[model samples]
Target: MNKPFLRPESGRLCAARAAFSRRAARVVQFGIAAACVALPLAAFAPAAHAERADNDKPLNIEADNMTYDDLKQVNIFTGHVVATKGTIIIKADRVEVTQDPQGYQYATGTSDGGNLSYFRQKRDGLDEYIEGNAVRIDYDGKQDLTTLTTRAVVRRLVGLTTIQDEVHGSVITYDGQKDFYTAKAGPDVAGPGNPTGRVRAMLAPRNGGAAPLTGAPATLTPSTKMQGTQQP
Candidate 1:
């Protein structure tokens, strides 16, 4: 998903972009706690909080300047790569992801931390980013899931509950398409450890992904011709 994780049919933004927008704000919030909110992108819970709760994780993605369909068909790059399905996500720093000769798709996440300190991932949400220092990630072809956790931190910059030193867990799950995710709070954690607040959510499936104020698509098309005098 986009850093913001909000996808528009205009295709200007992708899911990963949406994730970035929501979570990237946290890095900024640590300095200033102004009027900011977490925007959950995946299919995670706590209906209300989940609406804008972001996953706390950092990631470095490298796509082959290709479209979703291209990523699906051509295994283009020569280094580690990643991709996502309905609810599944992948990680591979120096790997390649393309259609296998057998018509099967493959991707790999390498174990390298050059400038990479931690990597965060939410099933399909943008707000939350699963962050950890040293990490070894593995992808199982079984359930189509990506797991990463190790003395990791799950932060939520949502509402009055801006968590910086609260819940700590060693595992997180992300599903790309299903748009659902769940965070497991570590044992010795505190402060809003459990997202149980009830507030009106701005974005939801029913709201068509937090649609614009237009409420509906506009039908105004401006003409740019001065030929009204002699045009057939």
Candidate 2:
């Protein structure tokens, strides 16, 4: 399998078009909604096989307005768009999805309002969860890469309160296949009082006290998902 792209200087993802790993390719084929839901877990843990399978489940979306341009092969969802797959959830003002002729998918989500686009996902077989906020998020299903840009902040938590890891940067990128990530400052510094344009990260030491995630739902079964259709 090809290596996923790192955060490039342009603050945009530039993943090479190549075949994905067996695991990620299956997740990609499951559909865009499911793929987008699984891309935010780099802060929590290296998603195990079970986690990737969870992402292959059905993707549900809610939005005020949506449009699909068949000619251009682009789907756009706007106005309080919320997408969910299994335990993962994403909320933004607008989201755009497009596919390559080869059936690879790309998704971009942006928050037009003051608040950043939000993402949350439960860790595989763990009490911890991952959450993030960014002005925009980009996912490349062909490469199993997710990029967060503009005042990006990602955190890992245990039991909804105890933080396990946190990262702050202008751009943060995660590789789903390898469970690797890179963070850096963007050309334009964003966020409150971040004039120095530096990346800040706080990764909690392993073996820290962690409590079980009470009331968390059990894992859902994976299934062959319908492609490209919007959810009500």
Candidate 3:
């Protein structure tokens, strides 16, 4: 009987091939896990369409008291301030506004004590609106961006009552031009409900229908004229 002979190099080659196969299998498993994690986020990544005409409108502010600094070109409003520009509305205990040389406006709204500042804007040609609450709110007219800082909660509403989607974070930045928003997590938003201070979002299905949301709803109405003193 002929003795079976196996080359030493052949056994080494077989072992190397087995190791590569195991690594490739693990890589495929990791890819599948990553895709599972990304699918839910991608479903809600559609861009919003905000009102384009609001950019051309003027800023109108109402407050209990107003002070204007001519040299600095700034207007400070205090005591229940409400500012409106086209379909956009901002409410806070204090608001500071400044206009640039090119006629673009910037505003910073802050709440007193433990109160939260409010912001709302209508969507373009739709019955929907975007609203948010935070400790501080900033609006940039030139870039059409809104930033909410510290315990921020933003929501998408249908017909001023039904909430379609909601997001919570320590800070949220909304870009009206791009119709998208981003949220960041921080310790400021950590609490009993969210101890880890992670960004949370609740998105509704896009079934071309509005569902009734449970809870008392608030309404926002835009002012046609300025309620505070306008400094030239």
Candidate 4:
């Protein structure tokens, strides 16, 4: 049987949880509470707008092995799968992709063993990027939504380095169209590091007069070579 991610109650665990609560309180004082509403803590800010042309771009994937089902129009890639669509990139141990009749594509990525799947996408017309990690990541092309489940953590980075904001929860649903996201807390995220398993966020103040960072169009390079079996 697999062990739970959460550890048993202990004095050390309680202290860690208390420290986390204090940090969360400090984060709220910084700015999270201003943009977030209570009960699961949803934030609506002027960030996280994904590249507009990403939806039109073709989905490219590389993996060590692949299985394509023509009747179902599904492609499953396993072993170090790296998928790219425009400025968006996802890396996982396994990825299943399916296309709709209208040409839109959907993808689900799963982690490799205990490691979490990774996702990154550049913000439209800005020098910022949105990155996330989770045990499972589901991307809906038609709806322009990315849902991260199980120990989800999402961050907004200024340029390539500076982390402007971040959120943590058991599940996070990011709507690219609306440029917003909602997070839910649950037992899946309950661990020794977070005993309460509550949603936590650190938001940067937007009242500064500084203009949004703008730059030339960003490009993504596939991480690995495409060497896999494909049957049509």
Candidate 5:
């Protein structure tokens, strides 16, 4: 398999199409609706098998709004733009969740009834459940996390500005929200003439985290995941 690209200089990601941060996030997408359901553990084996390699595309979901309500009938949250199940954990800005006559539920504004997925798992090593904007998760509800699809990316909190992406299909995972990260591409610097798949530093790495460098640096790893991964 081909080695992956690391966060190169601005010019490099534009050329190699690897810098997810700088690239236009026209993500690959599917939809999830408003509902909460759970899947069992057996469904994870195949998904695990799919993750045995690192060279596939990712799962994407787009939405304008998402909400989860209980049977009681109350609003949760609104104004979310997009949610992704990429090489990281589930992310959504405008997210609302609640419970109803049935149980915990989730809803989005996409189709007035968007794509939604539900599953039970141990979150952050604690017993909990997850509702999505549309995903089906299967888990043993145990020590390890079990995702049910080949398209899902697992994310783990590495640090305040770092989250590791352990993708099933890509040799390269992103160390988002930072200028400096360790790419499997090895330690190197990016520059003109030498680009693409080369792990290089940002020629002009903007300090997105310039507040105070509150915490320590987060490390990236191959097993950085969501269901089976640890939270910071």
Candidate 6:
């Protein structure tokens, strides 16, 4: 068999092409791995008002002291810690946050001294917010669940001041992803005659027609609008 002689320039060109192909393959593999990690982290992000896209905004934290444990990959914030991401905000004396290998995040907040921990998030498509306070609060980023315990009180506020709805109990659980909550009474309410106690809810009417407690007509005493319309 006769072998054909190859040009040196041709040989060098063939080697360059082979090197380029290998680099391109490695780049493609790296991109695939990056996307896999990104997708899970995006799915596990915490949402405010059932909107996941809004939750993807940057998260900023302020604290007097912070510590991170490499072994557990946990972050601890102490002494007047405040964290905010988009329209969601949390305040606590101490907060511990951990993320699992799967990119799921868990946050726990505890009160120091007599101050209660707080959490607040703006409602979706509405000029309102949901705020709560308790001795301790836990938030699961993966599940979008928030738990408040020990004198837990949650309220829906209108325009930063007016209370549209309220829930009071010893334990309260809220599903931010679903915009729903459950409240239950605990030992603090289980005193004296009220053995099993009760959870209290003060919810406003969606139609704005009746008083929440009395179910009576939502008429203002000495109706200002009526008085203004009357002929002088």
Which candidate has the highest TM-score of all?
Answer: 3
Global lDDT scores for all candidate models = 0.36, 0.65, 0.79, 0.77, 0.28, 0.69
RMSD of each: 23.4, 17.7, 16.1, 18.3, 20.7, 21.3
Give candidate 6 regions above 4 Å deviation. Answer: 1-48, 189-197, 209-232
In model 1, the Cα lDDT at residue 26 comes to 75
lDDT of 1 by residue, 55-164 (tens): 22222345544334463563433244554443234444444454445444444444455522233334223443332322334443333344444333333232222222
Candidate 4: which stretches are off by over 4 Å?
1-44, 207-232
The better candidate by TM-score, 1 or 5, is: 1
Q: Give one digit per residue, the lDDT tens place, for model 5 in 169-215.
A: 11122211121112223112223432322222111113332222254
Off by over 4 Å in 2: 1-50, 100-104, 187-194, 209-232
For candidate 4, lDDT tens digit of each residue in 1-232? 9986976789998999999999998886655343221223235355447899999899999999999999888999999999999988999999999988898899999986689999998888889778899999999999989999998988777786666667777889877877777787787766664455656666556654222325332222211222123235
TM for every model, in the order presented, reads: 0.29, 0.63, 0.72, 0.70, 0.21, 0.64
Candidate 5 Cα outliers beyond 4 Å, as residue runs:
1-78, 81-98, 101-151, 161-165, 169-232
Model 3: residues >4 Å from true position, as ranges?
Answer: 1-48, 208-213, 216-232
User: Between prediction 5 and prediction 6, which has the larger lDDT?
Assistant: 6
What does candidate 6 score on TM?
A: 0.64
Q: Across residues 74-191, which tens digit of lDDT does each residue of candidate 2 receive?
A: 8899999987766667788998878788766667889975879987666667776667789998867667667788888777777678766666777887665566666665644443
lDDT of 1: 0.36
TM-score for predicted model 1 compared with the true structure: 0.29
User: Which 10 residues in a row give candidate 2 its minimum summed lDDT?
Assistant: 218-227
- Model 4 worst lDDT window (10 residues): 219-228
Best to worst by TM-score, what's the order? Answer: 3, 4, 6, 2, 1, 5
